[model samples]
Target: MASSAELHQRRSAAVARGVSSMIPSYVSTAGGGTMTDVDGREWIDFAAGIAVTNVGNAAPRVVEAVQAQVERFTHTCFMIAPYEQYVAVCEELAALTPGDFDKRSALFSSGAEAVENAVKIARHATGRPAVVVFDHAYHGRTNLTMALTAKVMPYKQGFGPFAGEIYRVAMSYPLRDGRSGAAAAAYAIGQIEKTVGAVNVAAVLIEPIQGEGGFVVPAEGFLPAIAAWSRAAGAVFIADEIQTGFCRTGEWFASTHEGIEPDLITTAKGIAGGLPLAAVTGRAEIMDSVHPGGLGGTYGGNPIACAAALATIETMRELDLAAAARHIESVARPRLEALAAKHPAIGEVRGRGAMLALEVVIPGEDTAAGPAPDAVLTAAVAKAAHELGLLLLTCGTYGNVIRLLPPLIISDDELDRGLSLLEQAFASSL
Candidate 1:
């Protein structure tokens, strides 16, 4: 195994400069809440592969399922030679996703692909050309999704001539706006009505809990209000739960928390126990609107990925990981709140279940001046935590939010250790 420095040198030469990695070292093995790098240094994993390893890395059931699947065959391309695992995965999705209505699903290779398909389904079903999105939201990196995404620098800087008819509106950001859910919703609805016009809209797409956009949890009634407006306007309400789905938020989907039943929901990240799999689950009529040949890719639902997804769903059920996410909230939220109380730099702590964040801002009178993001301090704290063997991830449109996404299966002791390391990092960085 190469040393971290040697591997980084090799990677710089071989890997594209555009591809970014959060950590300095290369991992050799990972399970539960920690990963060991090539140098044999172990670091507690709070990032959870950016919430992809919700069932924990290499869980026994997922590993067994993947091995059995590989033994049977790796690729048959479901479009050509469909397999049982693919069907089974879809069936599970129908049963597990938020809405109780008769639903159908289409499998894809990434969250971005799933989102693109959802938008396609929406436009086809409604016979409308316009799509609605929110500020500080992240759908994906694909051209269409990049248009949907709000960030400019890293995601959409060079990518241009993006898909048209995608409209952006203000989201229900309580910390910044200090507006009630209804007021925020009214403002957003007014913007849509005045600019995009409800008649022209095909879909109102948003992250139930905005990911990459700082884990911004909408005000209590915000999501329900948006869903209601979308319903009244005859537009599809699409929940982009790509980062907050599959028990990451203490529910099968975050929309469930608000009791908002979306017409379509896009999911990935935690769906397949780290394998590349994504899905768009929604109403049957809407999904069926597309022609038979219109909705698949050659590698859309690979057998191995499907197998992993089925096993992952089963593991989530068997372990009651939704409850585990709640437990994580119980344990982590207070600590984060306490950290905020102690450090004036931490302007807010937001999010639900296992998905949480600390918005770093300028301390004291400057905080009152405005929500001035303290990106430098955020970078220092993340860097400190990484060097101290606790991996943390920073996000936000302003690049001033520290997000914690520990694997659901992480032990109490491991979580405590990570929290302590974070505190130390805060003390040192501040």
Candidate 2:
């Protein structure tokens, strides 16, 4: 077993020094909902590789599919050879996504790629030059997606000359703004009307539940309002479901709870169960708007990822992970909420289904009170959790929110164990 120091030194040499990790212990392998480092130490994996392994790491069916696909043929490029798995998964996405009407689906290699393509499709369909995005929204790192993304520091840092025709507005964060969902939506739309002029906008992109900005769930009526505004403006409504889709939010997609069908939906993360794959699924009309040959990359829809996606979608259905996500919420919310009640530092706890977070705000201070360093105890809580064998992440524009996105397949005992550690961390921190 490698010592933590030895592992860290080796990793620095082998992997890019720029790659960031919260844990010094390197996970060699994972299963179900937990992972072990090369040092033989185990940790409860609440991160799920930032919500990618929802079907549980190394899911049996997904493994088998990948193995089978690799043996059959790893790549012929779907745009060139075109495989059955690609079509099958698209079919599955069409069925699984919220809308019942005719839909079209396209596969890509990464979440960023899916997002960029969705924008391109929207632009081509609407013949509009402008796109509206929300502040604190995390679309991706690609050039276009970087412009689409809301946060600045790391993602947008030094990468400018971003795609033109991009505009940003604030999101509905009650803890930070003290505004209701309706107010946030109205304010955001007003920004568009006043600054960007929605008349030239091709699409309005949003995260149903903002993922990188700390699993922030907008107030009720917030998303519906935006969708309504977009419809009236003749702009495509794009829901970036890369993090919130595939039962992470207790439902198939967070937008479903609000009864909104996005014109173009970008999905990834759990879609292929830890495989490098993403997708854009939406109404046939909008998707077909793109001319043939408009979208296709060499490794866009690798056969291996497609096979894994097929297996992944099948596993989610057979195991009913959507219901499992609801079960997770039933288990986690009460325990986490109890922790919140006991700790005044926790200003708010909010989310839908298994995607939830507790905002750690300094008492008597709002989350937006000067950059979240002195106030939110997020760093302390995260440090405490890691020492006790639990992984933690602090997200949000201000870095004041700690979100939990564990695998929906985690056992009751595991959830209780993780929560117990969390409670102990809270008690000791105070």
User: Per-prediction TM-score, please?
Assistant: 0.99, 0.96
Give lDDT tens digits, candidate 1, residues 292-371: 98999988888999999999999999999999999999999999999999999999999989999999998653554258
Which residue pairs show collisions in model 1?
A: none
Q: Which portions of model 1 show Cα errors greater than 4 Å?
A: 365-369
TM-score, cand. 1 vs. native: 0.99
Query: What would the per-residue lDDT of candidate 2 be over residues 94-176, giving only the tens digit for each residue?
Result: 99888788999988989999999999999999999999998789998988889988888788989898989999888887666
| Candidate 1 lDDT score at position 407 | 97
For each candidate in the order shown, give its overall lDDT on alpha carbons.
Answer: 0.94, 0.86
Q: How many clashing residue pairs, candidate 1?
A: 0
What overall lDDT, based on C-alpha atoms, would model 2 receive against the true structure? Answer: 0.86
